[model samples]
Structure formats: structure tokens, C-alpha cells
Target: MRDIIEPEFEIDEKGRVLCKTHSNFEFFSQPKVNRYQQRELEKQLTCETCSHFFNDDCFFPRSEVNMIEYDRKKRNAFKCKLCGNKIDRMLTVMHKLYYKEKYNIELPLICCTCYETLKDGKFIESSKWRSNMFLYNALYAIYSLISVLFFILVYQVRIYYLLVFLLPIIYLFYQNMKKRKEIKEGMRYYQKYFIDSNNNNIR
Candidate 1:
């Protein structure tokens, strides 16, 4: 079995849930898509029975992915340069660091699995700090201790003060649980995409 880490999704500055492994395609790695080039790639890719067909238009004749089917469909969607799978997600490969246009050109739609394998399982970006359970646990411990001390030393008469003190911790715990549930749901979507009916990994 291939040992896989549970993929972590980071909330970007734009509030998008993005995978951790992000990278630029190598400088000379862009694909050529004329008939002759497609023929060449097809011979090498036929072992996997996958298509390496490319077009300037979108790869999917009709895709359920909105950004792919609509926004980027005509202009940016193309065959994945790596495995030749239908482009599902595009990775920003080129850009000006100092200029406003952060991503000038995006690579073909390379799925997350291929991206991970190509990068040798190194995540380029990370937000695991947001979900560090130990940190939350420590905060919970400290909060509980402080609440008990405050109740005993300051507000002993009204038991309601303890509930008031504990409300923020309760809300924090709720938010943590909600985020964990969301992550689990996201992982399920990835598993669905990668696993096929024959139990073979498609990506």
C-alpha cells in the first residue's frame, strides 16, 4: 500500500481551500501539442491507456468543474502535460514576483495525485499550524484552569459566571470540530476522484 499523508487544505488569503503541495513546472517542461508531438507522447503514455491529446481549447468537451467549464474552459484548460489525463486543475507555473499579475501563465490541468508524485510528496505550502491539535488541547487546559481559579477566587456566589467564562472555549471547540468535519468531507471527495470501480488508482 502506498503510504499517504492526509492532505491538508489551507485557507489562502483569498479564503480558498487549497492543497498543500504547490509548485511550478520546470522551466523546459511545457508540452508541445501539434499532431506529431501528440503522437510521440501517445506512444510513451499508451502503457497506462491514458490520452495525451491536447488542444488550445478546454480538454473536457463538457466539465462539471465550473472554473474549468466556464471561466478557464476556452482559454486556459488543456491536456495535462505530465500524465495526459484530462486537465482538472491548473497550476500557476509562471508569474512576476514584483508585478501585480501574480500568475502570468498556468500549467495544464495536473491533478493533485500527479502533482504530489511529481513533487515527491513534498508540500510546498502549509497551514497545519491552524489545525495543530496539541495547541488547541493546551489552550483548553489553560482555559479550564483559569476558569476554575476565577470562579473560586472572584465570582464564587454565582455559578453562572463559570458558564460565562467557559463559553468562549466552548465556541472554540465547536469551530475546531466543524473544521475537522470539513476536512474529512474534502478527503472523501479526493478519494472518490482517485479510486476507480476496479479498485485501481486512476490518479
Candidate 2:
């Protein structure tokens, strides 16, 4: 008799994965792409929602697409230009070492696996960069949530004097949420584009 694999509980025991749909719960629950990728992708590709080939005035502004195509002429299929993994997303990277200086060498399409692994830590950022990022995510993301609760408490207390104190925190929270929305939009844009492309291919 074959053994059954039971559903696994979430780390905090808040939920359980019961099927294929639930396998990537966290990844699905939230946006996939980050802010940096969104800004970069927008700068390179056409309309994020457009089904047409991503060749727009914005695409490869720093370099010629024909030259990039020539570079990959030997390759028969799309793959990560950096690690040779299957293409998941396009990344327009500035290559200082590859050319005279200040050149956009757009060939590498990053796979999702690599994106997840390289998005964090010293792998992609310097120590100072990581430290600033930590401060932002920790200070703003966490403190903003805390401020919401504090706002309610202050309001119930009818403490008008504390309004001055709470307003700044509220403003910061709003800014953070705005940034979060942009990042989420970016993720949704790319995920939908790729998924739709795959579906069309299958059809």
C-alpha cells in the first residue's frame, strides 16, 4: 500500500495546505515582483498589460535591441543570459565592465528561482544597502501597523493633543502602503503577462 502525504500546517498553525492550489500559498497570497523590478521593467518593456511583443520606445533605451538579438543569434531558445536558466522575467542591467562605460546590456532574462534567491541579502546588495533596507522594512512596515493600533487607542482616549504625534506616523504608513501597491501592481503585471502567454502557447 502507498503511504499518503498529509497536508502540512502553516508555520504559525494558522492554515493548512490541502492541494496543488495551496502549495504556493504565500507566493500567491502576495505580489511577486518588487519595486526595483517594476521600475526597471517599465523602463524597458512596453505597456505591461499589452499582449504584443514588448518592443516600445521605452524598451532598451540605452542599447539597441538588434544588437542584443545578434548576441543571442546562436541560441535557439530564450534562457537567462546570466545563469542560463529558463527565462522568467526581463532584466535591463547597466554594464560598465562589458563596454567603454555606462551601457545597458539587455540580454539576461532572470528566472523566478534566481530572483527569489538573489532579491535579498549580500547576494544583490552591499552591507550598507542591506542595513538601510532592514531599517526601512522593519521600521516602516512594522511601526506603521503598530501606529494603526496606537491611533485607535489615542482616539478612544479623546486625546486631541496626541493627534499631532499620530498624524506623522499615519502619513508615513500611507506612503508605505502606496509604495506597496506599486510593487504589487508590478508583480501582477508580469505574472499575468507570463501566465497568459503560457496559456496561449498551450492553446
Candidate 3:
């Protein structure tokens, strides 16, 4: 006679593997791992209807097998899992590092979909404001030059015209300080928002 080994419990829709036996039956759950990698995987796996694929907050397999396969294919060439867009992970990493150094912040590893969304949303606003500030400063410099000519023209009137000329210079200095503060604040807000939003999405 042959003995039979039965599974203790049924595998749920959440990708949990259950062990079932005659003597003892219990549900076996996967363990937690690095969240950064997990978030990247979440963005990649787009099929929501698949029962085998559950959200990370619920019980699910860590997909080690898939990860190994992905790594192998990535070494050769693989498409972005989310959008089916071809991407080079190494080049992506280098580009990310370049931007991080340029922007002075650590950007979370993200796929093209998320990156594009973020760029369109927050980055565009910051860049626009920065550009406006530059334009304002340039205009201020031109105005200062015009004011100097006005001072020269009016110099024969009285020494008071010289004091009047100093007013615009002082105002320009104040505007420069204010613009600098605004830039610093804008950058801080953007960096904080980026970090917080990505962290929340991952968690």
C-alpha cells in the first residue's frame, strides 16, 4: 500500500502557500524583505485581476524565482514590466545618479511610468518657478542699468538725486535675497514631497 500526503490547507487567492497533512495542517506565509526592491516589483507587476498576484500589504510570495529570471533577462535586455517599454537598468542607474548629483537629492529607484508622472507633476512646477526667478533677476539688472542712467541725468539737480539712486540698488539687493530664499524653499519642498510620496507608495 502507498501512503498519501495531503496538503493541510488551501492556497488562498493572496498567493499564500499552505501546507496540509493528516497530522498537522497550517498556513505557511512568506517573509518580509527589502521594501525598495518590493516597491519596484509592485510597479512592474501590473495585472490586478490575477489571484496569484496580490498586493504587498497582503500575504504573497516574494517572487524570488521571477526576480532571478528578471535579473537574467535584465542582463541581456528586458522591457519595463509595467508599460512594456524597453529599458536598460544599468543605464537607468547611471542616469539616476547623474540627476541626483545635479539636483542634490537621492531619488528612489523608479520605473519610467512613475518617473514620468513625477516629472510632469512636481518637477515641472519647480523648474517653471526657477525659470521665472531667473527671468525676474535679469529684468532687475536691466532696470538697475536704466536707473543708473536716470541718476546720471538728474545729478545736476541736487545731491539728493544720488540718495534717490541708492534706493533702487537697495531694492535690487532685497529682491535678490528674497529670490534666493524662495529657491531654497522651493527645492526643500520638492525634495520632501518626492521622498514622502514614494515612501508612502512603497509602504
Candidate 4:
């Protein structure tokens, strides 16, 4: 006789289970597209300055909207021929598919233009402190090395004299800290801008 065992639990990407089964197997649906992909598609489909597809002259034939009335058009009104869904929503769906097929990444919803832009560029240019930190640390190390050499050659100072060379090190440290703080603030500002831009684009 075959043994019968009850199912343990269900699995899902967002933790919301859809069903339970008699077998001891689990299933999970895919996750949504990511913000990076969405941002990329937005860049591809819309004008960087205005987040619309066309300009005053309607230079791009593929654009769905005329530049003049682009702002007045509702997002839900523009339908995709392939999916019969809103153009923006269709873009998000396509982006998710593309991300899965191309990069093997299960991303959240992303607009068409943002996906294109990210695919073309590979990644966004968000500010980070690592670069600044590297620069400051490199400079400080170089200056410290030079000061140690000078002390040894001119004053014949012992290796302990290296401790006295920390004046420049402290100064550079302060500058690096300040610069890192500024970069962090700038990152927050840009993050806010990204969120605001996404909200406006959806509307």
C-alpha cells in the first residue's frame, strides 16, 4: 500500500499562500519587477525632461501621444495593442518578463521606458560614499607615507614619529566625513526625486 502524507505548508514570493495541497510539495509564484527596471523603462519611453513620449513637433513616430496634449492624456486611456491593457501597465508586465528572461531577476513592476533605459545602461548612477571614501583614504595614505619619509630623511626620527604625522590624517578624516555626509544627503534628495517622478509618471 502507498503511504499518504499531509502537506506541510504553502510558499509564495510575497508570503501570501494561494492554496494547500495533499502532497508534501511547495510552490511559489514569481516576484514583481524592480525599481531599477522600472526607472530604465521610464527613461526609454518618455522624454527625460518631461516624462512624455513626444515633443511639440511629434518628432518620434512611435510615440503614443502628441507632444501638445501629452500631459492631458490619462494613463489608463492609452492601451497597448498586444495586451489590451493600459500602456504603462503593459510596459510593467513586459518589463517583468524581460527581466526574468534576460537577467533571471524577478523584478517588481517597471514602466516600459525605464526597463529599456536600464537594459541599455546596465544600472543607474546613484551616488554612493564608497568612491569618495576611497579617494580620501588614498590621498591620506599618500600624504602620510610622504610625511614619514621626510621625517626619516631630514630628522632621522624613529618609526614612532609616524604617530606625529596624524595631523594631516585627522584633517583628511574630517573632510572625508563631511563629504560622506553630504553625499548621503544628496542620495536622500535624489531618492525623493525618483519617488516623486514615479508618482507623477503614473498619474
Candidate 5:
């Protein structure tokens, strides 16, 4: 239920949920942190998967979050300093901000994949990310197949009202297309900043 959101038939459905850490704390006040009180005093944490964290509500980098890809050529378009792989923009920034705030150390670009590495200094991206992604895709494929079969059956029967089954499929497709556009443009925008910053750093 919390993993995905289904938008209305006629409306744009973008899933927005706070990561566990920030879910406790909203805009106005700090969420209750019993053992984390000391850490809370130092700096407010940001959710790496949220676009709003970057002050951009126009785009949700779902691709960056889901990162569903196997092509090595497309790995980490913005190479992470740690793994030299495509990295999540928000995760990198979140790591930077957290380190700067907590340890007073500035970190270079790091990916969510490198989290365990950073934690244990092992430099190995956990396989769970890929495994979880595979699971999601497998489930998605099942959904798509069912949708196609349902659509075909309903169409062949020429049932008028039963076409409602297709509505969810159609709605999701449109929403997917809409988010794909946003992700495409969002990557470009992030790429521009990456280039500029890289150039500046090199200078």
C-alpha cells in the first residue's frame, strides 16, 4: 500500500511518501527522536528519494529512485565518486549534507548503493538493491500481462461497461508516460548542474 500509489483515472497520480526517518518530522517541528535527539540537534535529515527535498516539486526522479536498468553503458550517468557508477542525486546530496552536519566532513558524490560501504568501509554495494528491483520488475511484468489479457478479452467481447477494467491500465500508462517525461527532463537539469559543478571543481 505504501510502496505505490494509484492516481485517479483523470488525474495525475504521483506517489509521494516520506522515508521513515523524515516521516516523523514534518515542516514545522522536529519529529520525536528519543535516542536520536543528539543527532537531531546537529542537523535535520533529508529523504534521498524525495524531490521536494531538493526544492523541486515539478519533478519526481522516480527513475533515480527505482533505478531500473541493467545496461552497464547507462550506469550512473552522474558517476558516484565512490563507485564510479550512476548515483542518485538526492542520496549524494543527502550524504553530503549529513556528513557536513554531523561529522563536519564534506563527502563527495556517493550512491545509496554505497551506503553499507560507507557504514562498514567495505566499498561493496549490497546486492539487495538489485534483488529488490528484480522483484519489482517481475511483479510489474505480471501486472502488465494481466492487463493486456484483460483488455483483449474485454475488447473481444465488446462489453461496454466491462471496459472499466482497462481504465486502471490506461490511467497508469498515462501517468507512467507523464513521469517518464519529467524524469527525462529532470536528468537533463541535474546533468547541467553536474557539468557546471564538475568544471568548477576541476578549476
Candidate 6:
């Protein structure tokens, strides 16, 4: 069983919950998307994922916690990069640091499953991938639809004339398929990896 510490937040002077432990509270980590759409301003700022409420070092009442990520995290709308599942857009301080240290890339706002998958060493070179596979999926669907159209046109007397139009469509699909393969290949892992819990700073 994972030992997730209870959320350690404190009431501010105004009696509002707050956590001032992040490396930079004013960091430009929030995406250009609708960051404030859902009402979790307090949670986002406090960052329950951190072990420190404000960098409590030794000798003092220090902050400490184990590593725990989430899916169905908040009632916000953000999509996962791998499975294309809906997720909240809570880019905690840990995620930002992890991305920079591990992948040397920007932290992607992913669902819990994808985050777990990444920690388990099934994903790498994530920067080459996309946040959504919608365009790739649309390409595949269009190719299938065009194939059905080709079948219907094959029986027509103007089949030769229709071939010219279908040829261009087929080329486009081929290019998109090649790009899709590249995206999937980037997610392949060279070896299994695991993130050990800090118990103090956490993964």
C-alpha cells in the first residue's frame, strides 16, 4: 500500500487554505488553454502533491510526502496525451520538475494512467508525441471511408476517371499513417524504469 500523506495545508491570514512551498509560485507552467475554467484555484496553488508546504527543512517542522499521481483528478477538462482520455489540467510542481529532469521537456498534462505508464518506463521521448490523437484518428477514418468509396466506384463505368481522384486521397492517407507510426515509436521505452518515492521530497 502506498503511503500518501494527508494534505498538509494551512489557513492564511484571511483564513484561506494555502501552500507556499513550490520553487516558483509565479512560474509560467500553466498552459495557454482554459486554466481557470474549473474552480480549483486553491488546490492548484497549494499543490497537494508536494511534500513540503513551504520547504520545511530539517530541525524545523519540515514538509514531506510520498509520490502519488492521479486520474479523474479534478472536475476540469484536459485530455491525456497517450490514451486521449479526459483529465484535469493540474500541472503540479512535481510534474514540472519531473519533466525537466527526466525527459528534459515540458511536462505534459496527462491522465493518471498515462502518468503511471510513464513512471513505469513504458514511455520515452514524449516530446515527439502529441497531446491528442484526434488528427491521426481522423486520418485513419477517412482512409477507411475512401476505401469504401473506391469499392463502390470500381463497379462503375467511370472507374478509370475516379481512380485519379482516389490516388491523391490514398497518398495523403499513406503520409499520415507514416507520421502516426513515428508518434507511436517515440513512446517506446528502451528499458523499464521506476521512480523511487522520496518519502521526503517524493518522485
Q: Which candidate has the top score in TM-score?
A: 1
What's the CA error at residue 126 for candidate 2, in Å? 22
Candidate 6 matches the true fold with a TM-score of: 0.28
Off by over 4 Å in 2: 1-114, 117-160, 201-203
How many backbone clashes does every candidate have? 0, 0, 4, 18, 1, 0
> Each model's C-alpha lDDT?
0.38, 0.39, 0.45, 0.42, 0.42, 0.44
lDDT by residue for model 1 (98-152), tens: 1223335332344444455535633212113323563476467567857676766
Off by over 4 Å in 6: 1-90, 93-111, 116-145, 151-183, 190-192, 195-203
How many clashing pairs in candidate 2? 0
Q: Indicate the TM-score of model 4.
A: 0.26
Name every residue pair that clashes in candidate 2: none
lDDT of 4 by residue, 82-133 (tens): 2122344333343344456556986443333333433564213423434366
CA shift of 45, model 1, Å = 35
Q: Which candidate should be chosen as best, given lDDT against the real structure?
A: 3
Candidate 5: residue pairs that collide? 76-86
* Candidate 6 lDDT by residue in tens digits, 50-104: 4343444411123322132333344323444454455443344344444565569
- Lowest summed lDDT over 10 consecutive residues: which window, candidate 1? 91-100
- Candidate 5: tens digits of C-alpha lDDT, residues 61-172: 3443344222223553454554344553333343444456556986555445544444564432233344345445545645885866777786785565445656765565
**Candidate 4 wrong stretches, greater than 4 Å:** 1-126, 129-164, 200-203
How many Å off is the CA of 193 in candidate 2?
2.3
Provide TM-scores for the models: 0.31, 0.27, 0.29, 0.26, 0.29, 0.28
Instruction: List where candidate 1 sits over 4 angstroms from the true fold.
Output: 1-150, 153-157, 195-203
Worst 10 residues of 3 by lDDT: 21-30
By TM-score, is 5 or 6 better?
5
| Root-mean-square deviation of every model | 17.4, 21.5, 19.5, 20.5, 16.8, 14.7
**How far does residue 141 in candidate 6 sit from its true spot (Å)?**
2.7
